[model samples]
Target: MGPSVMKKGLLLIALVVGGGCALFLYAAATRGLSAREAPSAAEAYATRTFRRWAVPANARLLRNPVPPNPETLRHGMEHWADHCATCHANDGSGKTTIGTNLYPKAPDMREKETQSLTDGELYYIIRNGVRMTGMPAWGNPEDGENDHETWTLVLFIRHLPQLGEEEKHLMSTLNPKTPSEIEEERQEEEFLSGKDLSKHKSTNGRKQ
Candidate 1:
């Protein structure tokens, strides 16, 4: 073939391969972020900086969360439904029409297939957020329980896979608040903050 024709053929093949990659990643986008050009040169080479602080590469589920109590679960369910279900989904699959649009994508909790970390790491990720990765920090210095809420969410998440279809259906609207639990919740929310949260709830969480 002529050099000109061969060069044209190679360019077309390159374009097709590049386009396929774009579509593949587009299908993989997580959370609510939009897809566009690929990450910048610096971003492409970047790795998790969270390791400096002991955070893991992937989210970890806790094993013995204190107060795996129903009240905390109720709190987590509510918080997740309002704040997270849009992307992570009520089931934590990180699969949703919205979540799949995000750039780096979201984590799917049920797929213990990909997870490898500790509960503390997951709590830190929830409270401190992962910059540029679409994960948000839950706690502000303002709301005392935001960190508590973060851990609580992680604790609840650890329980996902073990939950039967009935439990999931029930979770669609379950509130752990009996009058007694509500009283405890009201008091706990008023009193807990920072590291102190570790004491009020027990178990820290366990494997699903």
Candidate 2:
């Protein structure tokens, strides 16, 4: 075929593919992509493909500088509990109400799909959140201080499969407490310290 004819053929093919994709998206939008519903196979594939390509080659190859020690693990656990537990859960299972409701859904880190990623890849995702996903960028790239925290998280992600119940219990304490929880802790401490319990009496004369 002549150069002009070949160009025309390729252009026609592109137009056809683009039109089909537009129609599919339109149909999906009308059908309702509910947050509570699991992502369709095509949606999952496209999201994964985009994420795979989004990370730079250098970022994927970069290694974690922080050593995987008990201290680092503890810090990572505390960080996860305070900041990530709401969505990811203490065990990285992503089974929490918020995690399950996200459009694409938070992935369970212990699963092969997540564990298969390299340390650097995981770090990149943590430092720079994936687009169109609930995961947020936890680290400021310009802040050197944030790098260690994210690297530690990468180690923690690796440790998810081996996470212990004792560690999870410890994390619960580190997790952020509500005002009611803080007040309850204060009252418990006072009671243990032999403070007057009469002040805590309810209308029925029972200690609340």
Candidate 3:
């Protein structure tokens, strides 16, 4: 209320922030900066709180323009399968190899920590990505106000809580497979169907 009290409040805030940073640095130094170690509860809370504050106030208030529908949700699911499943997984579990190994590890999107975020916050994170984490910014500067794909993704995130087994199976089909995985599937299918696998061999002796 008064200048003296306002100054004291600011000083107290500054002291808390400085102390937190010092402790973080000490932990990093003592803990040896290992990715395998899960973040402490305090660290996790601070990071989440900081991320929430980092988003612009206006951006947080913005709403998804893409209307949710079966078609749109399918499109979003497909996009997620091809692009996001590597880290987030088809069920938004964030349990894949890459996801589990990250320093902070990818979040379990089905949980309240993620689901509690507003659609706008989700969209912002999807488009802009959080700094100092594995997420990369996906927004194109040219897209401007017409980022329909990102908005649709927000809908899919909301749908994650209700993800069905069939939907996960479809997403697996849509996931980007490595060449070896494709070849393995082909070989398995041929063997199961009793097809002549040898006839498909190439000159290099690799499967055609």
Candidate 4:
């Protein structure tokens, strides 16, 4: 074969290979993009990765002066209902309206994996929002370095497993009546009277 013909054949092969590679990557990207609206394997992986690792760091470094007061829990619950309930759901089931449209899908907090997460870890996730996941960082940039509100939220979320159906309704829609929930609300009103809810723990390892 002529040298010119040989060179042309090699160039053609290279073009085909490149095109194939590009197609594969494009498919993967598009698949992930679509999954954000409806959950796919990729979205599950993203949630797992964030819960396993990302959350811990955010709480330890970003969330400082963690408050252990019961009022903190009450405040957190109120904030959650207003800001997070749309996606996380009232039952801690994590059934957001936007979630139905995602391909990767959001998580259901009522499930064991989410319920088992530590308060500190949950705080970090709330403060620093997971990448590529629907979760957002509600951290306060100015006070985040010493924020403790994030931990308050963690405390409330950790109790998801123990809440009854009635409690879930009130907690999600701003009407909880359980003594503890009621007390939490009262405290929330008192503590949050002059405070904000947009601001922020580290929980690692399975207790069991």
Candidate 5:
């Protein structure tokens, strides 16, 4: 085959393969993509492939302006506890209820699949988020603060496997508390102070 003819044939094959994949994905979506069910091996591979290709080349090459220092990591740790720990957990092991239930599920950042990604790719994903996934676009273009925070988060992600017990404990304290947890703490404090629990119980009963 002539060079031009061979090129045309290759393009045709590429188009056919792409269309077939798209149709397959559409069928899967229509069949009800369940968060509880793990994705098939093929589906998982395709998703990862698409994500890698989706990031722009320039973005992938961009360097992290924020230095990965102790202070930056500390800030990242605090931010992760307050904002990300609900889903990603303090250890970056997406094992929390929300993370586990997400369609396609959150990834364990400490794993090779995540750690192998380029620094810029990680930053881009954090800022823009992956489509058709539970991850949200957390970085705000209008807010420079968000950019700095996200860069720090990337550093913290790199430190996940090396996270210490003390750091986890600090993060646990910083994590947002549910209303029930807050009330439980209050009651515990009152009990420790020898305050009457009967009055609190009667007040709650009246509200109910």
Candidate 6:
């Protein structure tokens, strides 16, 4: 192609991109940048497009080195419960309080929107994380190409569609508990064991 033709093509691309940016800025200004509101369909499309573009071409083709087996799934379930369950939920429903409140909100991983993604795409997202979203990079860059845990997570994500009640129950057992929750459990255990309960009762020194 001649220089003039190439220059014209570049100019057109630039104009399109600039126009898109202007429209985005106008929307932001008018709508007010609030995380409480869900993103519009246009915004969602743009975000997905950007995420696709951000992943490296080679990364898209990369395969999980970890073997998918019962053991691998168990380990992935444990890791997910301890770490990801806070936002993603044990069922991959993303229905937790924190997940629902996130801007663009955490996705329901059981749905086609997440399940349709390739294993490599899931692994890449887990390792690197998407910018302007709640996801954080969980894998260390120094881990090189042998990030077994992240690969295991990829397998677990694929298994979300087939998640069982028993699996979810196990994950709930593995999930992290807050101090209050732990304390409540301790008290319940004590009560269940027929331990003294006077300390927990109101101590106003008045007869009921």
Local distance difference test, per candidate?
0.65, 0.87, 0.89, 0.65, 0.89, 0.88
Model 4 / residue 82 / CA error / Å: 0.5
Summed backbone clashes in each candidate are 18, 0, 0, 18, 0, 0
In Å, residue 123's CA in model 4 sits off its true spot by 1.3
Residue 50 lDDT in model 1? Answer: 36
In model 5, the worst 10-residue window by lDDT is 138-147
- Of the pair 1 and 6, which is ahead by TM-score? 6
* Model 6 residue 18 distance off true place after TM-score fit, in angstroms: 24
Error of 4 at 185 (Å): 24
Model 2, 157-206: lDDT tens digits are 89999999898889888888998899789879989999876666553474
Give the Å error, residue 78, model 5: 1.0
Best by TM-score: 3
Give residue 161's error in model 1 in angstroms. 1.6
Report the lDDT tens digits of candidate 4 across residue range 5-82.
Answer: 999999999999999999989987776434444545785677677557645454544433456455776687777777
Candidate 6: where is the Cα deviation over 4 Å? 1-30, 197-208
- Candidate 5 per-residue lDDT over residues 162-194, each given as its tens digit: 999999998999999999899889889999999
lDDT of 4 at 32: 47
Better of 1 and 5 by lDDT: 5
**Over 4 Å off, model 5:** 1-32, 143-146, 198-208
Model 3 agreement with the true structure over 141-172: per-residue lDDT tens digits: 67855698888788999999999999999888
Write the candidate numbers in order of decreasing TM-score: 3, 6, 5, 2, 4, 1
